[model samples]
Target chain A: MPGFFKNKVFWSGVMALVATLILINMTSSERENITLLERILRDTYAPLQSRVTEMRDYLSGPRSIFIQKQELSERIAELEEEIARLNLSNQILRENEEEIKRLRSIINFRDNNLDKYELLAARVIARSPNNWFQSIIIDKGSIDGIEKNMPVITSKGLVGRVGSISQHTAQVNLITDREIAVGATLQRSRETSGVVEGMVEGNLLKMINIPYYASVKPNDIVITSGLSEVFPKGIDIGVIYQVTEEPNGLLLSATVVPTVNFSKLEEVMVITDFWPVSEETEAELPALAEE
Target chain B: MCYLIHFLLPFLAVFLQSTVFGFYSIKGTLPDLVLVFVICFSIVNGAGKGTVYGFLCGMLEDLYLGRFIGINAIAKALTGYITGRLQKGFFRENIIVGATAVALGTLLNAAVLLVLSRIAFPSFHIDEQFVQGVLYQFAYNIILAAPLYGWYYRSSRIGLLKLPGEK
Candidate 1:
């Protein structure tokens, strides 16, 4: 054996191999607990990363920003005029809503309960440097009352939930990440339900374990099934692209194309407060409270 | 000051990699500036220092991710070691050599990640998209290798990157 093979460098390599193997064994993608070291590092570096992003945006172009500001002012005026037109239309809609409320009272009908959510707007500050993990870092964090498992959404549809959080920033695993799954249902055929899983690609989602005989097909809209503790019921998930029978013929699966263009995600709304009431909870409610 | 610049280089590279390079991503895969640096440093240095530095950089990446600890660390360190060992057969300062090393390093990095994940977690499955993403990253890393390797090669020539002392 060569003398170099017995040197300190070789011993270091061997030690590293052993330590890394042990570390990999302890690694978990669904880890709920964050250690003190990881927390401090993420918190300390996240701010610098956020500032670098702002600097990049600032240095993009001063002239372009001025032009954009002028255009935005003109657009704001246009929007104000449109808002007045909408206010007239909204007044008529308010009368219709009041009529509906009265009719519902007469019929003892339950209101569609989705707007109970309070949304907090957050900016996309950074994204995962590696492609193996599909996560985005938002500027808002626990300081903004964002917590783990909080559902994140855009105006178009569901994005993902907060996975981990620091003081000033939070990491959201996108719905297309491998480790995330949402309770999904078919909007057209309420009976057709499945779990929407994140796929390797950012655009594609896999709706798994659909009943073999369900009437789901391409163009069918998929929504949240309200079956999970995290995601609210009736939030749009995606449109089914291709439905196919599973290899075993026991269950079917479909490819759902999400409405949210995740790559282009700039601003998102994190649902801060939502207490979903299930049918079980509804039945347990007292009549006096309803009155 | 020089040592501080060298120390903070990985952090800055990673931040810019996630933010600035994110805009230019091709199908969710971007050029990994940290990996490129690892390869360059390994090519200039030897397998021993390359391996240690790769491990540290990978740890930094994992900490930034705040999820898994060793996935990137193991993969990147292995890539650095392999690239460093292979550099013995090449003209280390040549851009082509550097770019070729990057191409191999990127592929090796992806393979190690895939194999490690597959072994550690049964839920993880490799699919067609994984292959496609790796290819896209391979292209991006090669594109980045030229300028990065040139800088490292020149820096080593000027003694900013102190070579490993003889055994």
Candidate 2:
């Protein structure tokens, strides 16, 4: 038989194996930060991603009402077409009004919770491409004071923490990823505490490692216990959906449904910093004990 | 123009997979559009080119969002090579043939990716829910395979992405 070294198929196989080895060796982990080249790539691609999102939103237009009124949508479309031909400006104005209402709500939420966080308003641009990682790309990045590991949130509740940074965009790993864990407590009865983590199941989170005797029930609200450095205290995590015993029968675990509807998430607030007391005031106790 | 189209097709699919679809993700999964694109692209081309294309595409995808590299590359390269090689005997002009290829390609891609992922990161539980998620994604790829294949077939017919030695 011909020598194996001279066989083209064998060489190709060898080459493939070598190539895979190189690629695997280059594989990275949960990096603390990205390289300059990655940043540039992210910066360049952010605008394209942003444009696609804008176009999708503009074309899809006020998704909830459109979806709900599916039966009337065809009639509405015909009517809108006629109106568009009659008065194009009127159509644009209507679209703008809808857009304005949505933006205003986001702005209003920040204003209402001005005391809670020094929030930076940002629009979600994209999400992790693969099924494995649950993350989103936000329009704001390092340039916007969005450092790595900063907590991102919405009016509904906590969203996730910033993962990687670019000049113009940052990847916010959603709370749904299996990797994330938060120190959580029962808001109604702070006596019960556990570690909240993402589940391999559906869009549900699991709070585990609670004492078997602790009182827990469905609809019980879970909030951050301030035990973790990344997230602060009292941020809403979710409501306890179902409670179950661990396989070991030692501790209890509960399924939690997140407050923020991640599917329809559009805008969010990146918490740059938060203090237990607002910056306008200082912590001090009056010398009342002297009496 | 032809080369640019060849490069841009998968990139556009990746962008779409990552961006607009993310907002409407049902049960936190979307169709593996890039995988679909690779299989379809391979069906048009042959094995040698398909394997190379698949590897490059997988590398690009891994670099973009992979938790660990080489998982997608290895999976996709195998998918591409097998699909491309198998396409020769079938009537690829038929959407059913292309769809079948995608269905099989999806299973193969899932096998490699998931097995490798589980081996590498044993922390991720491979339970009933995870299996269900894979099934959902596989079904989506099958449902979506036709339209993308049709686009590629039409584009190739029109000489849009014909490489220098493709024929």
Candidate 3:
């Protein structure tokens, strides 16, 4: 029996047979139950793994404390210098408050006449690994009134749309994802339709299907068209980098540099007030067309 | 005792490789200290124990990586078996022999990963760039293997080292 088991070919064949049986069993098992097992493992291990990571970090603490201390002292000096400048800015701000009050009276009158969209501020805690093509993780989630397909933006411009929402976290699929399609228009000439597509490298975006008749130039601002009901009209997407007339002679393509640097994103605003067009609204659209 | 060291050593090496060494890379290309550990384990322990340790370690790695759930488990088990078989033929249990074995084992591990990943994820395209990346990782792991094996041999001389002078 020992001699039979000791044969290399015999053992190899035995192992292969066992592995095949295990693989078959694993694959043929109930998928939902397997998914539940995976989720349970992930949930159980994630916190323990995070704690272990934290402990390891703590164990490797303060290797460069002396250098960091000097850096912190220099940073303090810089902050002290900035405090003086901020004091001057504070006085300027007081003077500007009076002017702002005057402007507010005018803006309040204008705002009352115009439609308004409510915005919510959310802080970003972590980003997905840099290797993942186009995804971001933000702190706010379904619990914070964030929903899938909500538009994420920054003070600078449009960032991306929310893709997944958990109770405490949300994943934003950036405008740079290949699957994400946004309706946009040229801000300068008011060209009504263009599709924004993500390029593969270097956080670049391209606006496709722009009409050749529309005069688009370099540096023309592109804004969302609000046709898809995902983003509101007039939110900035990017400035056009290059424009080329396609061989078809009907449509032009323009490469755009996104306004928000997806690499260094720290905070964003979730547009929560825009009611997405419902099935009822779709049903009423034909009636309105008849009218 | 050997099993506990096997568990702790690979975990420590991976943690340090990711954090202190900063040697993590894109895709499936990273310094494979676990492979080195398995090679050393197989050399010190016999083939049966080595194969078992390799399978368990590879399973842990698969769990951490969250992809191709059982592929590494199979590959590492095979590699462990081969290394253990080699131990019977060329049974020189010294630092130089261990280093050479690990270097060759690293190459074999990368080749196995490349072939398996290609077979498994055809659409994912692990191309020339990825192969080059693995070569770079191979060089890095080879450079670190000697000193790491030396340290293990010194600290855990019970199973790892059987010097003529030592009783």
Best by TM-score: 1
Better of 1 and 3 by lDDT: 1
Residue A54 of model 2: what lDDT? Answer: 91
Candidates' C-alpha lDDT: 0.83, 0.80, 0.65
Task: Give the CAPRI rating of model 2.
Answer: acceptable
* Cα lDDT tens digits for candidate 3, A212-237: 88888899999887676787777889
Best by DockQ: 1
Q: Please give, for residues A49-154, the per-residue lDDT of candidate 2 as tens digits.
A: 9998899888786675646566688879999899878698777877976686686565442122334468899998888887867778899988888887888889
Go through the candidates in order and give each one's DockQ. Answer: 0.62, 0.43, 0.14
Give lDDT tens digits, candidate 2, residues B96-122.
988999999988888887777776667
* Candidate 1 segments whose C-alpha is farther than 4 A from its true place: A1-14, A55-112, A276-291, B163-167
**Maximum-lDDT candidate:** 1
* Candidate 1 residue A126 C-alpha distance from true site, Å: 0.4
In order of lDDT, best first, we have 1, 2, 3
C-alpha TM-scores of all predictions: 0.85, 0.80, 0.51
Q: Model 2: clashing residue pairs?
A: none
Winner of 1 and 3 under DockQ: 1
Which residue pairs in candidate 3 have backbone atoms (N, alpha carbon, C) closer than 3 angstroms, thus clashing?
Answer: none
Tell me candidate 1's TM-score on chain B. Answer: 0.92
